[model samples]
Target: MTVTRFAPSPTGYLHVGNLRSALFNWLIARKAGGTFILRLDDTDPERSKEEYVDGIREDLEWLGLTWDREERQSARLDRYADAADQLREMGRFYEAWETPTELDLKRKKLLNMGRPPVYDRAALALSDDEKAALRRNRGTGVWRFKLDQERIEWTDGILGDVSIDAASVSDPVLIRQDGQVLYTLASVVDDTDMGVTDVVRGADHVTNTATQVQMIRALGGHVPDFAHHSLLTGPTGEALSKRLGTLALRDLRARGIEPMAILSLMARIGSADPVELRGSHDELIEGFDISRFGSAPTKFDVEDLVPITASVVHGLDALDVDEALSRAGVPDRLRKPYWSVVRGNTATRAEAGAWWPVFSGHATPEIAEEDREFVVKAFEMLGDPPYADDAWSDWTNAVKAETGRKGRGLFMPLRLAVTGQARGPEMADVMPLLQKKPSFD
Candidate 1:
């Protein structure tokens, strides 16, 4: 059976960039009736907080990206240790004792000689005595995986055939001096041990994927199919990394962006398909095609979510917005009619709150100077609250006949005077929801 995993470090909130990877993995797994694992890369205990882990779960729940199971690297420390030991016994793992300054100097010297800044494996030349002396002097050095100096190639699920020269790439550090298991080793161990069959992430990990392919083979594990989706950018193609802090999923939810709106756009953004508002997870799953996605940086505009959210809101039934309507203080009796009245005009369910005040007559009226006399006369004919079904038509007809006003000139002012807006639900539908009659006095 097919299996996939989304491993995120529980160090911060999930932004749109993170959402893309999660959504892709989820959709892929769901489409194939496969298992999707939510793995927490919390090896850095100092930075990873339980609150962030909770936030990750909450965000995924909000997006309907339910995982079949969850795994944390913190809980699997012994497994990583075993894997590291196995690589060391195979002569593929070695201790590196270079400080950051020393490594930087070596890289500079290599570049000055027009050579790739790959690690020169200076640690491999050290005798056991020298190694013991260095360990005593500098404490414990980082563990680096030895790459078989050859062309590492794979048929990427999205980027087509990919090839990287292992000779040009430095050996990856699997364990830090602080004894923390880095992502490369932990992910490789987890992916293999947990039976993950596919991996999808951002394009930035392409090189990592290449190195990981070698590491997987060296460890005697099946290398999962890997796809690197393009990174997201601003609307005009500016780098999205700097702006991710503001694009947290919770912030978007607070702004009343619908989950389906976010899901629909993300599933198809860089793909060949045009983004269409999906009403449920089934729709998104049925239409997802990872092969259809392009590798170019996807241009994401937060503004794009507005119209899609409005579309989602417009299709909602009364029960669909029951919570939002109730929070807006729309009584049970008014829920259906109130939604019917404002659903067409709203871009979000929260907008129902704005309309409730208008319907209840607590909103300030917006009458224009030229139409003040006309609006005052119109309201005089409106009488008191608990109006009849035809009350708006009757009152408007009386005002139209008395003033010879018609069309937009007649209806626009009346709407503005009553609801404090030039555009909203039709006056006919809005009339019955009024708790207090309009007063332009």
Candidate 2:
């Protein structure tokens, strides 16, 4: 069966780039009827933390992407060690006894000669006895992969055929002198051992693939297909990073962004395809295709996400909005009023007033007259009676019976009187709250 994996290094909060990578992987796995794995690459002991790993899992789940299997790279040290041993036995790797200072001098000397300062493979030509002596004498050194100086080429699903000569690439350290496996070695071993069939990750990992492909070939492991989707860039064209103040998923949710909004934003960013702004999770899954991903970097714009969210929010039934607000920790006192404004503004549903304006009007008393009137109308329609459980139907019926005037004109005056505003939350949301004793009616 086809299999794909999202391996995130648990060193920080789940950033937008990481989320995008996971989304693409999920899209491919779901589209192809393959297994999706979430692997925690927490190998950097000094930087990785349990909290970060937990946060990533929570973030992915929040985005509606679930993995079929999970694994941790740190827990599979023995597997990486075995791979390194096999490569060493097959003469595909050699222990470099050069100290940092020695390597620096070699690089500097090569640079002084106006040549690219790559690791000199001639340094690995020690005799068998000499290699054994150095191994016994040197207490600690890194193991470097011995790359065959030949051109390597592979077809990427997104980038088409990519080729790079081995001479231009460095013989990267597979295992540090401290015995901890490096990221490349551990990632390749884990992906192969877990039977991953497709690798979908950010474009930042595009250059790293060459070294990994060499490792896989040397170890006699199957090389999975790769698709390095473009990275999410900031407006200035720089890659998205924490230093750039990119928004986190939790932060967006806290700010009242609906999950579907976030998903829609994910679909649109760096995507060339025209996807409907509103759809169920299953609908999105069905429409997702790898070819839809754009090659150009996507700018992470919060403004672009607002309309998408509003579509999702407006399309939901009343109960769905209630549930979403409840999960967001919206207060009971503000729930009815907030939903009132949201439902009323659904027709306009402009990006500028979707969440904050609606939330502020409910939580604060600073709403405009027009907006407040809508709020009152909504509350009234939701069976929130005027003056202590007095329903609008009864009030309209009584007023019409006594004055011979219809219900339409009475709605505007009643709405204006209660909320002191003209165009805010609907009467449906306002009436229920106004039904409380000492009501404004």
Candidate 3:
């Protein structure tokens, strides 16, 4: 069966860039009706944390990408050791006795000579007797894969056929002298062992593919097809990183960002004309298109999120939104207050009353006070009766006469008070809920 995997190192929170790679891999697996695997590359014991590993799984689940199998590199050390031994027996790998300082000097010399500073064949000339002597002396040396000095080529699904000069590439260290497997070897071994057919990840790993392909070939394992998707970029055209202030999935979730909103944002991140996707996760999965991926990097703009946020707020079922607010620790009475404040500022309301007082402490004093007076007088004129056609007309005229404010000024503040935002649906659609005797305090 065709298989794909998202193997992220559990070193930090899941950022947008990592989420995009996972999303793309998920799309490929689903589109092909194949298995999707989730692997944690937790080989670095110091950096990888159980919390981060659990978080990655949660993030993937939130994005609605389910994996068929899960694996951890830390749990499969013996497998990698076996692969290292196999390569050693095939004469495709060797132990290098060069100290760190000596290797650095060699690399510096090569760079000075205008040549790529790689661990060339000079390290491979150690005799069996010399190897034994070094081992006997308790000398610590890394196991390096001896790359074949011929051209290595592969056809990338997205980038097309690409070739690299094997001579220019270094003999990569498979196992560090400390006996820890490096990323390249651990990744390839796991990919092959898991029967992964395609390798889909971010372009940041593009250069590493060459080295991984070489390792796979050395071990007589089938190298999977690759598709290097572009990275998610910030507005400044730089790749998205934590340093750039890209929010983490956990942070976004804490800020009340819906899982669908996050996924919708991720789905449209790299599109030429980014558009939000609505509906259930399954519906999104059915309609996902890899071809829609833009060649240029996607910018993580907060402005790009406004439309989706509005849609989420507007389409939210009243009961669901109320429940969500309640679960979010918003008081039952305060739910409508918050909703009203959000809706009033964005929508056109008949009049605003108690809603105005809620925004009195807000930074926009003039707007808040104006909306408060409107609601008070509108309710006063309505006289506690259920608002009807006549009541609506009376309330409108009363507000115009009493407040002497009209159009945007009369309506905007009320909307702002209810929604706590200045822009959203009109007040006419927003007032009915407040008229039903919702309490803010």
Find the candidate with the highest lDDT and give its number.
1
Q: What is the TM-score of candidate 3?
A: 0.81
Tell me the lDDT of candidate 3: 0.70
Per-residue lDDT of 404 in model 3: 89
Candidate order by lDDT, decreasing, is: 1, 2, 3
For candidate 3, lDDT tens digit of each residue in 190-212? Answer: 88888889887777777688888
lDDT of 2 by residue, 248-304 (tens): 777776666777777777766676775467476777787777767767777777666
lDDT of each: 0.92, 0.72, 0.70
TM-score ranking from best candidate downward: 1, 3, 2
Q: Report the lDDT tens digits of candidate 1 across residue range 1-441.
A: 889999999999999999999999999999999999999999998999999999999999998899999999999999999999999999999998999999999999999999999999999999999999999999999999999999989988889999999999999999999999999999999999999999999999988988899889988999999999999999999999999999999999999999999999999999889999887899999999899989999999998999999999899898988888888888998888888888999889777666888888788899789888888777777778788899888988898999899999999998888889877888898887799876655
Of 1 and 2, the candidate ahead on lDDT is 1
Clashes within 3 Å, all models in order? 0, 32, 29
Lowest summed lDDT over 10 consecutive residues: which window, candidate 1?
Answer: 376-385
Model 2 ranges with Cα > 4 A deviation: 99-114, 126-138, 242-245, 323-341, 344-441
Task: Indicate the worst ten consecutive residues by lDDT in candidate 2.
Answer: 348-357
TM-score of each: 0.96, 0.76, 0.81
